[model samples]
Target: MLNEKKEMPLMVRQSLDQTYDVIRKKSIKKKRTFNPQVIIAIAASACLVVGLGLSNDHVMASINKWLGFDDKGVEQAVNNGMLQEDHHSVTDQGVKIAINDHFSDENKLGLSFQLAFDHPSMLKHVENVSLDYRLKNGDGQYIEEFIPDTKPLKGKNRYTSFFDYQNPLIDEKSGMVQFNTLSDSSEGTIPKLKDAVIEIESINIFDNTGKLKKINGHWNLSLSNNKKAEEMIQYKIQNVSSAIQVLKARSTPTALNIVLSLKGIDKERDEKLPSDMVIVDEAGHEYRIKGLRSVSKNNETIISANFPISSYNQHKKLELMIKGIEKIHLIKQ
Candidate 1:
């Protein structure tokens, strides 16, 4: 058993290990160094983390049972101390429901709630978790679909019914119902949030064989809200015309924006965008896509993305990827 001096490193290591697991499970991810901001947050939150006893890690583990299996961005944000703990729980219809964790970053707000039934065998494997929720601010309410933005869902649904198929939801996290709200709206202007509240109306879960179990209850979870780190740059409306992208070369730049057309793509079926995205300039330097932006109009979906470019900027050809398949898109000079 490790002593007090080693527990701080262990906490961060544990968090990073779990994060690596998620990224690995997502096909292929890797580890990254913690930035100074994250280091500061860990130091501040680890005030009483270390102890003389052997059960040092159990204190924080008990608080966050489901934060480990989320997407890379959200997990990093959680490590940066964006998690708002909720200890309150509600029991109804022979089931106990509790919000495990509520995490917010600059772009999105996500929460995980767990459900336990009175009878053990009543529910076995849960395939899909669904719920009705609304986000409210000091002014009023804002209702959104269960559409997720950048952070991917924790695919933890167990598969016992299908004998031939492999279980895909084999995550470290189980029994946690996860949902996120997309805050990326029209350019600029976000409602001033003194405090944020999540009001969940009902909950439902489908078993591996597609059996629906509905539990009706009212649960409210409040969180400490933070303003946008930087003010959004609003774009002016342009006149009716068509636009085409042309490739250019440079040594270094602050950012790069690439747009992809989704002329006839099905949004519902493809709710989550592919995470394996990158851009390789003419100089052979690779830049990963991080800034996610999407716009839908007249049955067309267009993605506008921005990422940091390297110093060797010979922008001739671009390589786009999804599901490990790369498609080279060439721009006109």
Candidate 2:
């Protein structure tokens, strides 16, 4: 009876073992030493935070359920401090545009805004609305490879739009990020200026019958880069069969962007290159692929993919899983 009382329960023992394993691996990888007492305290705190005396598997399952790994994932991100809350507004020609919130990282900027029409009748005639926007730096220089993803929510009179813009030239600097056209993509040079002016030349509204109505005005706004908001992690691949390198990863409240470089590609067989990839966290939570783009620069191919993630602050390690890449022949032609 004394010996049995001294033994730890199976679930508790397993949880402690996993906790120790994670701490040991992180300490070794980070080259830091942790006192055993501190480790024990941290383990206890973790267990308490997750649930009183809950197994690791049960804790993760509860977390996954709370995160709602489905359509409500974005709501989970907003609750987890991944998205910024803003109340900026601008009005032009009786149309009010309110910037509600945004998520930004090194590679991309996502803006959520509400558009309210002054007249309810105007909403009926509008089948879609587009912003004609131009982003110029303090020196009037422009950033290159501006790609925009605009999504309009279902509504009348009051509508919401989420705009996602990708800028490879986004650095740790202040600049004006602006837009006003329906949608367009262009290439320009990276701006060196510290600030920028975003000018909206006009707002175009298309009716259900395809008639276009243009509202002409200069709607301008200024934005400064929040360098502290960005979080990036980089890892080097070891003992891999192919020359695939994950250059860096950026995590926002709403999404994760992984930058990769794949070497020795066959230009002739470009279609055979793998386009699908998955990011799995330590708890087996999978972040689905949002979008991907590949560009060739200086004889090297760089790939960038964005994945929507929920509860991103909970995980310490993520695995990048690429599919159907090994079968591709890499003979440069």
Task: Give Cα-based local distance difference scores for all models.
Answer: 0.38, 0.39
| Cα lDDT, model 2, residue 208 | 41
Q: Report the Cα lDDT for residue 78, model 2.
A: 47
TM-score of each: 0.44, 0.52
Cα lDDT tens digits for candidate 1, 1-333: 111210011111123234223323322221122332111111111212132222222432354332322223334445555566664567766656666555433233445555545664444544434454455655454423231222322223211110000111211122222232222211112244446666666665555455556666776666555432322221211221132222222211123334555545565422344255565545676655323445567766665544343222334455544433235454423
Clashing pairs in 1: none
Cα RMSDs of all predictions? 14.7, 21.2
Best lDDT goes to which candidate? 2
Error of 2 at 254 (Å): 4.5
User: Model 2, range 235-264, lDDT digits (tens) per residue?
Assistant: 344335465765645454445555678775
- Which runs of model 2 end up more than 4 angstroms from their true locations? 1-77, 136-197, 222-228, 250-254, 267-275, 296-300, 309-311, 326-333
- State, as a TM-score between 0 and 1, how close model 1 is to the true structure: 0.44
lDDT over C-alpha atoms for residue 185 of model 2:
12
The ten-residue window of minimal lDDT in model 1 covers 158-167
